[model samples]
Target: MDCLTSKVQISQFLDNELPQELLQPLFYHLGECEECRNFFVRTKVVHEGAKNVEYAAVPKELDEKFAVLEMGEKNVSLMNRKFTISVPTAIYSIGAVIVMVLFIYVSGTIQEKQIAEQYRQTMNLTMPFSEISYDRN
Candidate 1:
């Protein structure tokens, strides 16, 4: 492995699923590599935060109103022996070789370094949706 530069995959690396041989190299790289270390931390925070996003509640009245739309048994027939393979189920299946590559192109080049770019790409991919708990008057 050429040490994945993409923060999304870096997250998976931090989770200890990467090969054992690469682990030492990754740790060493993170120790000395400023860009990678920053990426790792930012990606990790977003990944953890994603696990905590809560689903909004559906009002009881709305639930009752939509209750009639529930699927009826008569419309659905189940096989006596429950064993089948479906086409849609294979999405992102095992042994899938999906290689995603990232490239950086800069515009309006800066002469000096200052503030770091906000890690929106990594966070957007990692974190689930969260809304502010606003109180209205």
Candidate 2:
């Protein structure tokens, strides 16, 4: 019944489905609701105009041209997709192999360095605590 709450109810009333209790409130609302009235009139005009119009059928030549263009676009897209895949696959494969080889070589060098350090430690055995002392000069 309130103007703010009556926008939708008034629209329904204009569609001829006014409930017995709502008819008076809906009418009163529409009289003061310029926005709702404008919407109703505009919608009614559009509905009437559309009802009198005819749908035109697509022309055969236009349909055929659209089909050809769509097919050509799809073919070009597929070729582009194939090119994208092939370029990345080849480049990534080579890059992955190079990375793996580098990782293996680095690991081998680290292991060799560790072994050399162990050997050096064993050769440089520390003197006994009793046989060594710091000079306080």
Give the TM-score of each candidate: 0.39, 0.32
User: Candidate 1, residue 20: CA error in Å?
Assistant: 2.6
Cα lDDT, all candidates: 0.59, 0.76
Cα RMSD for candidate 1? 43.1
Per-residue lDDT of 41-123 in model 1, one digit per residue for the tens?
88889878988999999999998887666644334535344676666665554324332211111222331111122343445
Off by over 4 Å in 2: 2-4, 57-137
Best by the lDDT measure = 2
Candidate number of the best TM-score: 1
Off by over 4 Å in 1: 1-9, 14-16, 65-137
Tens digits of lDDT, candidate 2, 43-118: 6787678789998998998998789888998999887875435878999999999999999999999998788667
**Candidate 1 at 99: error in angstroms?**
82
Indicate the worst ten consecutive residues by lDDT in candidate 1. Answer: 99-108
Give Cα distance to truth, residue 10, candidate 2, Å.
3.8
